[model samples]
Target: MIDFLNSIDTQLFLFLNGLHNAFFDPIMYWLSDKWIWVPMYVFMAYLIVKHYKMKGILIILTVGVVIALCDQTASHLIKHAVMRLRPSHEPSLVGLIHLSKAGPGGMYGFVSSHAANAFGLATFLYFVLDGRLRILKYWLFIWAILVSYSRIYNGVHYPGDVIVAAIIGTLIGWGMSKLFLYIENRRLKNK
Candidate 1:
């Protein structure tokens, strides 16, 4: 079962990577600049604040911090413990596509942080926000999916890496939302 899943994941990764390179890669590369992330972070923060007020803002921020921490920790563990080489660095996978230049330390690639972080934020926001922001939710999902695809398109991570990271991120988001709601209700009862 695991091998079957892995095979499917690899094929999906290749398909998505090709699609990303053909369409979304250039746009994401332009937008993946640090400054762009900063503004996006601020905008997401603003949305949380506007929708949920102070308590919601705090909860969202806490979730964001936790997600970031989880992303980093998981990436570190997989990179160090697994010692998996990136697809781009693998001679077998060479000529698959144009790969982005490697960063310092020859970082190991397994779980993708981009996938984790983007899906983490998207899932958390979708869970926390009430009412029918259906369009926004769709867009968020799209964004998360696209970001995950970027990792493979850049040849920095395997399909398994992004898939597991996405699952982890989604679970974290959902769990945090429930926790936040419970805390809020308890506080209200105490008031």
Candidate 2:
């Protein structure tokens, strides 16, 4: 069963890789890094503040910090400890797709920071702001899924890495939301 599941994952990864190469080659090369993501985060923070006021601003900031910590901890420490090579970096998987420049980075691929960060923020915001921003919750999840797929498409992370990162990110997001909600409710009661 595990082998079968792995095979499906490999096929899914390859399909996404092919799609990216076919349709988003320029975007992948140009807009797939911190430059794009940081501005996005800034915009998201702005929107959160605009909509939710001061409380929303504080929650967004907290979630941003948590996402950054989770992304870096998984990408740097756990990934290095695991030391799983990317498909492009592996001899066996070469020629399956066009490989991107390595860029300045470490040689680890157990979990994709891109996937974790995007999905973590998405999930966190989804739960926290769902009541007020019902439509946005769906868009946020779609955005997270696409970001996760982009990692595989860019040939920097395997299917396993993306999956694990997503799961870990979701869990962290959900946990943080619950924690914050509990604290906020307690404060409300006190008030």
TM-score for each model: 0.80, 0.85
Q: Please, what are the lDDT tens digits per residue for candidate 2 over residues 1-191?
A: 96796578667777777775445865675445667667766877777788889888778777877687778768777887888666667666667765656342356777888777777887888878846677667777887777777677677777888789888888888888888889888998999
**Candidate 2 accuracy as lDDT:** 0.75
Q: Write the per-residue lDDT of candidate 1 for residues 123-190, one digit (tens) a residue.
A: 87787666645566667788888777667766566789888888877877777778777888899999
Q: In model 2, which range of ten residues has the least summed lDDT?
A: 98-107
Residue 11 deviation, candidate 2, in Å? 4.8
- Screening candidate 1 with a backbone cut-off below 3 angstroms (N, C-alpha, C), the clashing residue pairs are none
Give the Å shift of residue 40 in candidate 2: 3.0
How does residue 6 of candidate 1 score in lDDT? 56
Clash count for each candidate, listed in order shown: 0, 0
Best by lDDT: 2
What TM-score does prediction 1 earn? Answer: 0.80
